[model samples]
Target: MSEVKEMAAKQERQALTGNEAMALAMRQIEPDVVAAYPITPQTEIVQIFSTYVADGLVNTEYVPVESEHSAMSAVVGSAAAGARSMTATSANGLALMWEILYIASGTRLPIVMPVVNRALSGPINIHCDHSDTMGARDSGWIQIFSENAQEAYDNMFQAIRIAEHPDVLLPAMVTTDGFIISHGMEIVNTLDDKTIKDFLGTYKIPRNLLDVDNPITVGPLALQDFYFETKVAQADAMMKAKPVILEIAEEYEKLSGRKYSFFEEYRLDDADVAIVVLGSTAGTAKVVVDNLRKEGIKAGLLKLRVFRPFPYEELKEALKHVDVIGVLDRSDSFASLGGPVFSELRAAMYDMETRPLVTNYVYGLGGRDIDLHMIEQAYRELLEIKETGKVDQYVNYLGVRE
Candidate 1:
């Protein structure tokens, strides 16, 4: 079984949008089913995929669904039938697929989707925010966030691998920052088709209870007694996915020469203060970390690659040596005590024997520019928390004044 196919073609160079990189990677995987509803940013992903289907580059059924709900439903149906399936959607489209999203994971189908991270509508804006993705965090699917075009392209393959890992027979979502990374063109070094085919391998679904010859029931009418077990099984599978996630990432690094982990530490060693962030802001944070290091301020960064499992233990271990930690949340969980990432990090270190002073900073909401200076400001805030043992209750809206 070739987990990932090797590329024989000349190491070719091409300028492609992040959307195109997604299609190119999927072309390599050669999923049997792709059911998608078109939306801005994400639409280009499906459009390019449709072209791949038309050109005979990939042997698959591309379902042009009428809506995102049908799109997710189509993939679920195909997956239940033992097909390697894929899909893509954004804000409203993702919301439309909510019901089927759970069905996909609960039924234990390894479906993969690309969610162009965007803000949900009320006053109506198509801009980027995790509101769409955050709303579905409770869904059983594994969620992975990509910081740039390269990570987005790389994660497309890894998502399939992680989802289909026999122990993790669940759906997965690869979310790229809306417009900032999705629309912005960057050099994404895509692997050769054969290399990807070997990396992801042909999808082999478990002998599902759905097989007619076996005459077994699947997703049957569960009483309250068994419903608990069914959900517990799902939880167990997600928890077990942590190790498999790291293993797949390591394998990709070996095969593709691109290293990845649940989170990447930039200058964390010997640093007294570190700012943890996710998605595109990590790029800006890196610049800030570099400058701060030169200024003799031992600052560092933790860029989250996997958001669903939350990497709690790993996060604690990652920041074990730091004196102060700053968790930057791009999206606000206003109802919560602080931002989402901050809350999670706090919980991760809550029971630790020795924990660093952690502070939460909420920035870059609704496509706000997360500049390097704001990142520097966050580092300063964390330092103050370390020095005075105090922090602010209100989420700091970077680049904004009351």
Candidate 2:
């Protein structure tokens, strides 16, 4: 038949929004279970995947729940039952699942959730911000930030492999900026279904609650007598995930012809002034760095991908030579001092032999525009710090009306 072709074909390049790309990856993954509730910004992902389920494109049991809490609970039950499970959410949806988030991780279920980063509500905004995931950063899940649609697509395959790895049996949340990357269309090169399937191999629940022959408890009461040890074990697994993530990324690179590391260092080695950021903002920062370099400003940028394990050591080594640094945040920490990213970054470099003057620029809350001009201003401030050897303002709100 001329209809069917060989599976070894080159990757297919298609224009896809981040939500569609993530849904496409899930269709290719064909996980055993996907229990989710619709939420702004993230609803499209599961909605598209539901179409796959309807069209018989995938064999996944799609469960549509009423609330994010129920959505997460259903997946936790599915994951504990030894099913490859996944879910997607945004903003308040993630906040609603706060209780179950810990349960999913505490039980060591390798559930993969695609969190569309959105600002948490009091004012009820349905836009991009890192506050949702940053709020759950300490919940024992690996946090991966995507710069664009392609990373969102590629990270899905890697997230499943990383989460299910025996040495690191933990959940992972691959995140994308709400409307910025989630709804923005871009050309993405996607692997064929067979390629991704082969890459994922097969998943067998090592501690299967469904396995009657080798029955084991999923989650039981842990007081101070064993709560500390249980936490230590989970912490150890999280630490082991660092190497597993890199290893899985390496394999995915060979299959996809795209390389990845914990974070991307864009012209940072010889930099005198550096900017460190996460999510879609990094894309804007890279452009600013290129223009600054053309003007002979030794400017550089580092875009962090993995945020949970923190990559403290690698970050320390990478920024050791830079003269001054700036960290831009899309979400305010509201702690009065600085945002979560800037705070963690300062702590990471605290023990350096000669730490650079660091500045925190909190911007883009509630999906506010963070354009090239704003990013250029951040770099200029870092240059000032480099020149004067002092930071006039340690923390700032970049585009606020004051």
Candidate 3:
């Protein structure tokens, strides 16, 4: 009986949607505060979490703020007050919190936000896209993208540890594709509550605003004299977070038996053509890679899990041997050059000894369906590029009507 109980306590598998997984992770963490506003695709996360708060499953201070901007502001204040704070948002909700996003990161608050990746509004969209989070890539937060419900839950646990690490005191966010991952259900293995609590331990703020004994000033005005140095310090923290992220991932793997890194490589051991992507599209791309492999086409994939601390060196090393690389971006940079991932990847390969020919494929904007056929088309283009050593157009749009 004792042995059976111990085995049962180790792990539990259940079907849960991406939003439910995130909410469950938060419930397990038992954060001190969660201030969030409802947004499409992101509503279920907070809705489910609020029930935990109401039912007293977790002793959390649930702040039902009026707007996303206020929600983030409340989290910043709570975090500054030495509380482990978090929130969830998507699309325009994230846009409303743009100003506070900088404040939280600049103040070095270890706030964890779960972003349900959605297309930002201009024409007003409530669908899955990378525009929302990609627009805020430079906001100094440690950004991690999830490929499925399992990754979404796992990344939330990792995000808490990553943000709170003393060496990497920065805000972090875990993102999943809106409507797709957020609404779709999948089997997820979750650790016991006690195990999660043991792993997370306690919240520690090195220099919180509410530490009356030490009395520190946060977000003080420093015009030309000290602002530059402060910004540089934030930049340094972002750089330091990369190693800390990997270390925490190592620890997490021991507990969950799931391995994670900056990026996931699939069938790339010896490949001539490859595709680099993020979010749920990686899963689609992998299926396409498997099909191409069966057809004797050397194709591979590199799915980026971490975007902010953009794994430049690791990416360069991963793709150096490939003949051609296709970077698929869900959001357009509108720079006329390429999308965000494409621009960064192209720049990363600039100084490589044997750089692979890379091209940009912008796809799946405004919840556009990126089926296997579209992915296969992209791989076909890569094979052509590899053979010809020429790119008819450096920037191309996939699954879009001209």
Candidate 4:
């Protein structure tokens, strides 16, 4: 414990924006290859990393691709060749990689991506929102969300380990809200190069496409006969990732003195009303939870850090005690019922013996501000639902004019 504490004390604390933190982490990792196309919010990440490559700060093979689709394809090829590979993108950029996203995961390449969350384009908006990543929720990649620059940095280290683990050889992405965590500066405690290298060890995949002596086909066509079994294997791998994620997080805590879990619980143990949220909004919700607690309102918060394996069972256990819960979403699902996170939470709690009243609040679309007042109102509404034992509407939009 003393050694761990000493190691933590030795870590350098630096002021950086979320994109810079991610870039620094990548630099320390010194991945063999990086293929990315520039996109708003996420552009700075690749831009900074490219400089590292040019200046010989890191011996990385940087590939400037034409589009997000080509970028992902390039990463897939590099990773399949058993090289550590990564990329960064946001919004429409992620949308462009939709096809390759599935291919990377399907082929079980451990490619790490930093998806700076931005609103998906249609009306043409470039701002903080989960719509981009949320749209790719079913793309078979491990998804982790960060609330601040510090978390974004830390999660980047964990993501590489998580994705490359033998039991969980799948693509993984770390997400930070665009222009919120991405562009905003904050203090981040970063591990030294040696510590990070030792912690991540070496990039060694069990199998690779480039292995000529013992070769195996990747992404081969499987029509109906073996497709189901392959999918089962993928599902099993995802299930196995839950425990691996926890184990890696525990080890990370030992190195950095910063603990992490699938979801962070803030005063949720004995609360009657709670709000659940993701990304930067969790910070605002935490402030509201602290204020409400001071007022003896019994309000609490559940901030989801991992959204991929969904943490269904653990989350169900965490929120089991609350009487009423508000699930906040930065992007709507357009299903008319609720947003992505909200719908998932509802499904997780559906089988519980005594379920709490859960409502969905879609807020902060197109980078709209989600102030403390708005978060407080969500908690207040939860209180009302708890008292009346009735929810007028299951889905509600926050900070929007009706």
Off by over 4 Å in 3: 1-9
Ranking by TM-score: 4, 3, 2, 1
Can you write out model 3's per-residue Cα lDDT over 312-388, one digit (the tens) per residue? 99999888899999999999988668999999999989998888999999999999999999999999999999889
> What is the lDDT of every predicted structure here?
0.85, 0.91, 0.93, 0.93
Candidate closer to the true structure by lDDT (higher is better), 2 or 3: 3
Backbone clashes in model 1:
13
Count of steric clashes across candidates, in order: 13, 0, 0, 0
> Which lDDT tens digits does candidate 4 get at residues 1-402?
687678767988789999999999999999999999999989999999999999999999999999999999999999999899999999999999999999999888999999999999879999999999999999999999999999999999999999999999999999999999999999998988998999999999998878999998878899989888888898899999999999999999988989999999998998999889999998888888899989989988899999998899999999999999999998897865899998889998998999999999999999999999999988888898988999899889999997
* lDDT of candidate 2 at residue 364, scale 0 to 100: 94
Indicate the TM-score of model 3. Answer: 0.97
lDDT of 1: 0.85
Q: Could you tell me every candidate's TM-score relative to the true structure?
A: 0.94, 0.97, 0.97, 0.98
List model 1 lDDT by residue over 50-134, tens digit each.
Answer: 9999999889999998999999999888888878999999998999999999989899999999998887877577778788888
Clashing pairs in 3: none
> How much does candidate 4 score in TM-score?
0.98
RMSD values for the candidates in order, in angstroms, are 3.2, 3.2, 2.3, 1.2
Question: Over 4 Å off in model 1, which ranges?
Answer: 1-10, 208-211
